[model samples]
Target: MNIIPILASAGITGFESPAAEYSQLGCNLDELLIEHPSATFIGKACGDSMQGVGIFDGDLLIVDRHVTPTHQDVIVANFNGEFVCKLLDIKRRLLLSANEKIQPVVINDFDTFSIEGVVIRSIRCHRPSPLLSNK
Candidate 1:
């Protein structure tokens, strides 16, 4: 995570009138969002299976391989040859899907299944894409 110095002091407000006194040094996103940068990787979500949990398709998932996944934590796992993003239910030993329509994947053997990483955050872009014109 690369961090840059905060240049501007005044913050642009939306609702009310802007305040005269503004705090210096805006917080670093890398310091706030990520813990282990070496183990962190980003993956684009491909399906709507996690939409119920606010994780939609085309979202960018920040995964940390160093973080040990606990029960009920959303994790990315490799079941056999396929990669799946779901919640871990350690007590029942099942991979729970956020979507009710989809059935939960059962973890039969620990040897066959591999935990790729835990999804720390999900980011979605709300702004429209810039139109490209032919020269």
Candidate 2:
């Protein structure tokens, strides 16, 4: 059997709305966005080095530790004890930036480095959001 979902625009002020007509109780953002809950984490992007890939400063990043990092994949890593987000070049042993202004970094044997996780999802806030602000 085929099931068709009805489009809805619910606007209720403390009263029971027509939401009961829907099959599911509600939609959960966590359920939709997160795949591996235990291996997932969220971080805020602090620089424009990844702006070319649409990950701007102050954007919310959802990193997943369970996934393996492939070549040219956007990833978070611990480079010389500091956490940074960059594009991984597995074969070249380099960390690349999405923005042209930023140069790619070479991973040398002397430099301590480890891939932390993959950046699976990103969220951008057009307006100032209280959740992302220090206030």
Candidate 3:
């Protein structure tokens, strides 16, 4: 979906005041967030394994297949035929877990270990919905 650009300021502030004139901020969120929509897929974070990196359980991950996997990039990869998300160490060829308790996964073979996509963005809902929340 195409997003309409909103008139907003770029600077971060503790207080917000009424704008004198409404004008485009010269940017759109959809345009900035999404590069290739067709190749991008959404995945839900399942556990606290990535909590150190702020990726909590139930968080939505924006996976972009078009982007090239790089060093220290959070990625969804096939580890021994199982799909998992972890930090990629390209030079060392290892998958590092965010949680300190979990041991880093060393890449044995490049064939079986395949990168699905790079995690472009992460989304979390702070507020619970009325339907799901118990009063």
Q: After superposition, how far is residue 88 of candidate 1 from its true place, in Å?
A: 0.4
- lDDT order, best first, reads 2, 3, 1
TM-score per prediction, in order, is 0.76, 0.79, 0.73
Minimum summed lDDT over a 10-residue window in model 3 is located at 15-24
lDDT of candidate 1 over 30-107, digit per residue (tens): 767788999998887878899988898778799999999999999999888888899999999999989999998889
State which candidate has the highest TM-score: 2
For 16-115, candidate 2 gives per-residue lDDT tens digits of: 5445554653547787678999999999999899999999999999999999999999999999999999999999999999999999999999999998
- Superposed by TM-score, candidate 3 places the C-alpha of residue 59 at a distance from the truth, in angstroms, of 0.5
How many pairs collide in each candidate, listed in order? Answer: 0, 0, 0
Relative to the unseen true structure, what is the C-alpha lDDT of residue 29 in candidate 1, on a scale of 0 to 100? 70
CA lDDT scores, all candidates in order: 0.82, 0.89, 0.83
As for TM-score, the candidate ahead, 1 or 3, is: 1
In terms of lDDT, the best-performing candidate is 2
Candidate 3 regions with alpha-carbon error over 4 angstroms: 1-29, 128-135
lDDT of 3 by residue, 84-110 (tens): 999999999889999999998889855
